[model samples]
Target: MLNYEGIAASKGYAIANAYKLVHPNLSFSTMKIGNPSKQVKRLNNAIKRAVNDLNKIEEVVITNMGSASSEIFKLQATFISSPNFINEVSSVIIDSKVNAETAVSEILERRISKLKNAGNGKFVLDKIKDIDDIRKRLLAYLLNKNMSDLALIQSPVIVVSEDLTPNDIIQLSNKNVKGVIADLGTNTSHSAILTKSLNIPSIFGLNNISKNVSNDDLIIVNGMSGEVIVNPSNELVKEYSLKITKYNQTEKPLDKLKKRNAFTKDGKKIGINANISSPKEVNLIKNYMIDGIGLYRTEYLYIDSYSLPTEDEQFNVYKNILSSMNNKPVVIRTLDIGGDKQVPYLDNNDSSERNPFLGNRSIRFSLSKTIIFRTQIRALLRASIYGNLSIMFPMISELNEWYKVKKIINEEKRKLDDGGIAYKNPKLGIMVEVPSVAIMADQFAKNVDFMSIGTNDLIQYVMAADRGNPTVAALDNPLNPALLRMLERVVNVANAYKMDISLCGEMACNRYALPILIGMGFKNLSMNINSTLDVKALLSLLDYSLMQKMSEEIIKNACTVKDVIKIEQRFIKI
Candidate 1:
């Protein structure tokens, strides 16, 4: 048996025969170009067709996965339609006197080389793969070469590829594809996001696994531990089979707790809510017996459409989700755009920035575009009358930004009042994502009605590490002493002022972190809908008093994530 380690993108296990997908080499000798204008027209037509294909793919992806994952295809569609990329190809064709395919290949290669040599971080370097995928599709269309048809695979098998794009994952979803093992991709890649949503076992960044495994070799993909076993012995296969059986048996009982309230042994009732992206996820809320919607990401309404969603459109979506929740409190976060998530229509002049995460995004972007910001605020205020609703602003680092946002919201309300429109005043809040806001939580708590700790960005910004980059994923841990201290401070401020505080990050979903969070006095936790039952069941079994004592010790003694893990293990054993 050969064992290889990779980055675990999804959690599961799969044993199946390998099916390799190799890209055919499309090499053509330089042909004497007859008419440059004709070649340019052909290239433009091919680009149009590629854009249409991407749009269709985007619709399918949005239906299968959420809009957040579908952003990958939307981005590709925008990149192909960009003026810079199109102009580069046209210039190369006219100047080099080569065919459209040759011109595209040459320009893409040059652009890829330039980007790689720029020495940007891994987040920027990953875009190279996206550009390359676009090149492959455009070239295939121009040359009339057949692309890989994943639907043709009739039998179940694990897909092994050098690199798989979002388009590839969508195509493979229709087949009997059991799992995926790729040579290149990070846990935050589009391919990884799709597999996680589809509940497929997947491992990526395995470095040339396609070259080692034969076409029909028996393979075991252990996505939980990021291990891929090739040609495993019969004994090892039997061992894994028993392990899978045990896991299924344990998971079956957790489903029974879906309808139960999550309360500690001491009778402290904890609110278990879900973080949703779109209205379609409301069905999961009812199915999981969630308390409410803690974080309703509004960026999808802006990102997925060709233009901004009208106030009526946005109001209908928010109203439907609130009505579905039966008056449960739904916290709707304003549009968190810019940074990695960009909308082509929102910004006309697109330019690459050295550091986008720290740049225009979240509240800053919304505030800059007051007209757009007001429309969403109006819709949110209008929707408040439907059911329980709360409005929250993201990425509020300073007190001034919060004031600016409040000013606009108040203005929108005044407009509604002057027009004799009926609306309710929902609770207002700010996300404590930036370290500055966490440090000044006492002052912020005095102004806002509530605070939701966004641990995902808090850990990333606190540690100065990019969460989406695999190289720095290890440092982006919430258990880090600095991050915990920040959270502690925020919680203390919230308690002193009698303000409502909840943690709405991926950390809340972690089994080990749950005790510390509850111990830190967080009464509300929001996570994915699929995790609500398991987390609720786990919370009910723990003693709140003991967890609080242990968490205090952990915060005082633990300095590193490793130290925190050791402390958590000791408590678990008790």
Candidate 2:
């Protein structure tokens, strides 16, 4: 067994033979070119065939994945077919009238040129990520354009690769894909995000797993632990299989907790909320028995498009989510973009930071460009009419900054009324992530309808830990006494102000933190969809009075994080 660790991008268990996908050792410069006319015709046929193959794959996904999953694939195909993408390629092929390989290269070069001209250099680079594919497509066009390199792999296989693009990952869905391990990928990589969404087990940054493991060797991939056991003896497989069975059995009890309201023994109701980005995730609301969506990340509406989404486009998305949840409150966070996410229309001039999380990003970047913020505020306000919508500003700290957003909201409302546009004035809230905001939660609670503690950032800010940096990840603990003190203060303020408060970050999803949250009088916990039931179960099992006492002891005694963890374990049954 060779063990490696990485953040589990998705969830599941798989035992399969390693099916390594080695990158072609060959380079573009070494490939041979044939007769131009034959190559052109061959390349066109190959494109046609590849398109047809993709279409068939889509149909298979539609049947297997049903309506919900199929929409994602269809949207991806639409992206490929967009005028900005397809037209550029077609025009290049026609205008150049060269061999298919040359035509594809010319098209790519022209697109790169256009991107350079546009001045958003990042946008063009993000589009054509598969450098090897470009080379092969060109080579095939020149030599035998009609040739198709697509091959169907037999399954119960562990897919090993140098890296995977979003398009490549999408195409693998509903096929007998068992597991995926890659040589390279970051947490925010498109491939990682998509794989997580698909619920497939994956491990990336494996440096050389493919070279060591042979095809058809029985291997167990523990995604949760990031361990791979190759050629495990039968006895070892059975032992691990039993362990997995026991874990699954433990999970079965959680299902019974789904419909039960998450309240402690003292009858305190803790609201279990969810975080969602798309309409497709709305189904999670009912399935997970969540109180509402605590955070509705709106960046996806802008990231996937060539241009800024029209007010109507944004309106449709917000309205769809609102209507789908049947009036459950959704805290629609205004665009939180920085680091890897860059909107073309927005003048995001923040340089890549040595520590991107702590640097200029989120609300700071949005406020720098007021026009973008105002447009989004207007759209969100208009959508509020359809359901229980609340606006939460990200990275807010100073009082002046809070009011700055409020001023824009007020102005947008006035403009809407002036233009006879329909909208509802939803309550606004702020995310308490920066240490400044956490310290001033009392004053902030007095102004806003609610305060959501974004622990992911708060810990990053408080510990001065950059979560993106692997070396510092161990230090990113929300259970730290410093953070617990902040949460206590935030909750106490919310109680004083007669306002609601919740946490909507990675911490909310963790079962161990539920006792502490409820103990601190935080009745609302928002997290990813799958974690709702798990947290609910943990909440149901604990005595609220004991948790409260335990929480107070930690805050009052000023213990370290380890001490708090020990105290929590001693009290909570989990």
Per-candidate Cα lDDT values, in order, are 0.80, 0.69
> Residue 14 error for model 2, in Å?
2.5
Error of 1 at 458 (Å): 1.0
Instruction: Name the lDDT value of residue 285 in candidate 1.
Output: 68
lDDT of 2 by residue, 247-325 (tens): 6788688788777777766677888887765566776467666688898888866654545666787888899888988
Best candidate (score: lDDT): 1
Candidate 2 lDDT trough over 10 residues, lowest sum:
120-129
Candidate 2 local lDDT, residue 156 = 56
Per-structure clash totals for the candidates: 0, 3
Question: Once superposed on the true structure, which residue ranges of model 2 sit more than 4 Å away at CA?
Answer: 6-12, 19-34, 60-98, 115-154, 157-218, 224-226, 340-354
Model 1, range 1-574, lDDT digits (tens) per residue?
8998988877778888998987766776776596889999989998998888777766755665557446666788888889998999999889888899998888888867766565322224225556777889888888877555454466879899988754566566543778899987655554675576566888987888999998889999998889999999999899888877886788789888888889987799999988876677787568777789999889867655534678898989988887888899999999987555666556522266667788888898888888788989999998889899999999999999988988998999999999988899999999998999998888998899999998877888898987556566678666787788789889989999999999987788667888889999999998767667678877877889988888898899998888888988877652
Give the range of the ten consecutive residues with the poorest summed lDDT in model 1: 118-127
The positional error of residue 466 in candidate 1, measured at the CA in angstroms, is: 0.8
